[model samples]
Target: MQTNHDHSDVTVRRDGHIAIVELARPPYNYFDETLIGHLVAVFEQLDDDASCRAIVLASQGKAFCAGADFSGGPTDPQMPRRLYRHAVRLFATRKPIVAAVHGPAIGGGAGLALVADFRVTCEAARFAVNFNRLGIHPGFGLSVTLPRLVGPQQAAMLLFTGKRIDGRKAVEIGLADVLAPDGEVLAHAVALAHDIAASAPLALMSTRATLRQGLADAVLAAVDHEASEQEWQVRTADFAEGVAATAARREAVFTGK
Candidate 1:
């Protein structure tokens, strides 16, 4: 038996003990506060459902998530705070999540992937925490999550330089747990989730709780600082130049302002 739910750009479907939650905005699933909120709601529901032991997080898109849609230029100045506020709820979820990243997961998208307990990716997958490149401090709790996965040195390198890394490099740096072929990322992720789901449910939840203790609180603290820094950074001239340069596909020339 399968159960499906439609929540605008997000979809949740159950397959036995495994739940597959997908982001439905194809080509590039750029998220906003509403999208994050929908995801959190789905996770919360799945948490209450005893049948959902583990979750596979996938996307129908060229990029698993390419971060926020900046094509409309700067969004509401308060948007980052609101978006991160919703995002913190993801960390409070109870079940394990395996993210299938088939393409670029950039900026806040990278933060979204890190919210999962594990990540599955392919050679085609690209990961980047590019807030610095965009002339803003990293948000979505990446400062906490990225370092927790890849160590502070590697996390700092990625965050400070805003460099994009492929799946192999991601695995090497501990950003991803498993590697799959280009088209099979989601399959592998689901398989991993199934393995986790096969374990004794109570023990699994207990072990996971111990392993992830205090993580939600850490993300909460991180997002607060991230949001505050981003608020001021967004008002800088360098931020404007960064956005313009990215849209133009040119190198940004930032002046300290």
Candidate 2:
């Protein structure tokens, strides 16, 4: 098959019924537009392949994903299209993809983790939708998925407050299904995928499909809310305060604008 990805930073290898895709941006696998498109295409192909029984999502880095590359100066004209392309993978894929998370999965990072069918986080992992801290709105259907995992009340608190918490807390809130030792996340996910591979493929497919029917549309609606809330937050005094505090390494005192 012809592949459409930058394998230098990401790699895919298949062994029997297990397929492993590793995000390889070292130090932090911060996603860019190119990377997002590549991943969407990869997941699309995996969903179509009959030989592939299960997938393990792992990363080679200190942080699974630190979110988007924020070092570049703000305001990219292609931000939405780029972001939505990434969102497409999270929403459209039909296969069972399990994420093995370590360190910080913040901003877009958390979205990537949430899209997986199952997630295994190490003791050191942290999850957050931190666009409020960045003075940007959340993207990637988090408005729906976060709430679905932890319920509306908790979701609102996480979003409005921009809270980030460790892996155990993530599992406590239903964001992670398994917790493992540091650096052992991938091996654990692969083991789980092996177990999933033992199940009847058709049955697994049907079960997942039946459960996911309205999920895409619902998440799209939540993405709209993320944009609205994010836009408003970006315009508030809180945004400036957050940004300044982040730069100065201090806690922000939000006025609830």
Candidate 3:
């Protein structure tokens, strides 16, 4: 049996005990406030449905998520704060999530993938924490999630360098749990979700809740610090240089000024 739901930028479908939540933007799916809100709503609904024991989070795009689309949004200072407010809600979800990371997951995009309990990726997948490269502090709770996943040393390396690593390297560093063959990432993620779903649902949720206890609060706290830092960094000359260099696909020349 199957059931489907369509949101503005996301799709939710159920196949027996596994719920499939897919980001619908094509090419490079750059998340913004609306997309994140839709995801939070979908996860909340799935959490209430006893039939959904687990979820496979995938995307219809060359990049799982490139990051935020900063070019078009309202330039209001409160925009990112509003977005992170919803992001914290995503971390509060109850069900287990397996993220199918087929391509680049950079900056906040990487944070989205980290929201999952497990990540399945292919060699084609690339992961990076690029906030420093953008002359901003990491957001989406990456300051908490990245270090928790990869250990502080490895997380610091990725954050400081803003270098991208392929799926194999990501797994080696504990950033990804499973590495699937190219083109089979989503399939592997769904299979993993099904395996989780096959377990007794009540026990699974109970275990998951215990394991993830205090995580949402930690993320919320980290976001507050991150947002505070980014608030000042966004006003720096280095930020302008970084943005221009990124757009031109070149290395940034940052001056401490």
- Quote the lDDT for 62 in model 2: 90
Best by lDDT: 1
- C-alpha TM-score for every candidate: 0.98, 0.87, 0.96
Order the candidates by lDDT, highest first — what do you get?
A: 1, 3, 2
Worst lDDT window (10 residues) for model 3?
70-79
Q: What are the Cα lDDT values of the candidates? A: 0.91, 0.78, 0.89
Question: Which residue pairs show collisions in model 3?
Answer: none
Which of 2 and 3 is the better model by lDDT? 3
**How well is each residue in 1-257 modelled by candidate 1, as lDDT tens digits?**
56576697998887789999999888899998888989989999989999899999999979999999877776677889889989988998899999999999999999999999999999889999988888899999999999999899999999999999999999988999999998999989989999999999999999999999999999999998988888888888988888899889899999976
TM-score winner:
1
lDDT tens readout by residue for model 3, 31-136 = 9899999999999998999989999999997999999865542235566678888999999999999999999998899999999999999899999888889788
Steric overlap count per candidate: 0, 0, 0
Sliding window of 10 residues with minimal summed lDDT for model 2: 72-81
- Candidate 3 local lDDT, residue 234: 75
Error of 2 at 145 (Å): 0.4
Lowest lDDT sum, 10 consecutive residues, model 1, at: 1-10
Model 1, global lDDT = 0.91
